[model samples]
Target: MKRFTKFVFKALVGFLALSLGLVLLFKFVPVPVTATMVMDGNGITKNWESLSNIDRNMVRAVIAAEDGKFCSHDGFDREAIEKAIERNAQGGRIRGGSTISQQTAKNVFLWQGGGYFRKGLEAYFTVLIEQIWGKRRIMEVYLNVAETGIGTYGAEAGAQRYFNKSAASLTPTEAARMAAALPQPKERSVVNPGGWLRRHGNTIAARIGSVSRDGLDSCIYE
Candidate 1:
């Protein structure tokens, strides 16, 4: 029992240290990943500062596609999580109802998997990301790393590759399509808006009037 307790304590300490290290590393390192979305028709690493305010379209689209309750919560949304749990329970593999913070945790630290162990780690990392990176930074990283196309990543890259525009200038429909393509970015086409894209686009458009960019300022990162 004592040995088990010791092991647990050490693991907790190690987790804390590792989490801090990740926060520092992502903050300083322009995380070097191939742009999923091509920028200027050329695939390259797109790195931008965290302070950059993204297009209202992009923000609204992301919210519409991902977490609708991002503005109302701290790090997690229990209701969405419950729905996800019920869905995943009915199905075999795990499905996520993660908010942006939780998604950032999985994207940054954990492997893309649906295992219970991975889910727990994702939660741990989510807490850490929420604590360290705050809301705006989380949003910034999410936009930049979110896969925009098959092998196309980052908002700048996605905008230029899909619509021949910059991230700042993406229209509501364009942004909505990009956000909608997130679940299967590599398999799905951001450049071509198919059925899901059109449906999600319309959904985002309706929410665009209410999704609050101003409220993001209150996020822990901001």
Candidate 2:
């Protein structure tokens, strides 16, 4: 029993060291690929751009649509998680409460799916990224690596494919539409949005100004 315990302890230490080293390395390097990007099969269509090169409207829209408290949270949003749990208990459509930081960690380092093991690893990576990468770098990586559409990834590729424009040129409405499609990129079309998408996009657009005015997006700039 003592020998078995020693082996488990050593294995845990080795795993922690390797995961930390990889996360630290990625902080300085642009991630070239992710599990989801490869899973899509056609290969990633990413053109990694600096946060500045991606329009401010896009940033605001994403925050409004995804995580309103992104700038203030560490790696999780407790209230949103509670709400999601409560809603799911009612047996309606399932919902998610993952914050932007969690999503970024999963997108950049982990694969898709939900399980206790995967969620644990995602939480681990989320804490690592929030500590090592900071808010700006996290947002930059998220914008560049998120799967935006079928066979398309990143803000730049999504913009060009759906709007024939650059991410830097995306207007508020256009950005909101893009943000709206993020939850189900394969099903939602930003260029030719359905009525529900249009309404959701407009709702996000209305909140973008509040997100900025309330300084909920200041961390990225600061």
Off by over 4 Å in 2: 1-3
Name every residue pair that clashes in candidate 1: 35-153, 36-151, 36-152, 36-153, 37-152, 37-153, 134-221, 135-221
Task: Report the C-alpha lDDT of model 2 over 1-222, residue by residue, as the tens digit.
Answer: 999999999999999999899889988888898899889877668798888999988999999999999999998999999999999999989898999999999998899999999999999999999999999999999999998999888999999998899999998899999999999998898887878888999999898899889998999876
Model 1, 110-209: lDDT tens per residue? Answer: 6665778988888887777777776767888888777667555678877878888778877888888888888877666766666866777778777766
Per-model TM against the reference: 0.80, 0.96
Question: Candidate 2 — which pairs collide?
Answer: none
Top candidate by TM-score: 2
User: lDDT values of the candidates?
Assistant: 0.72, 0.92
Worst 10 residues of 2 by lDDT: 37-46
Count of steric clashes across candidates, in order: 8, 0
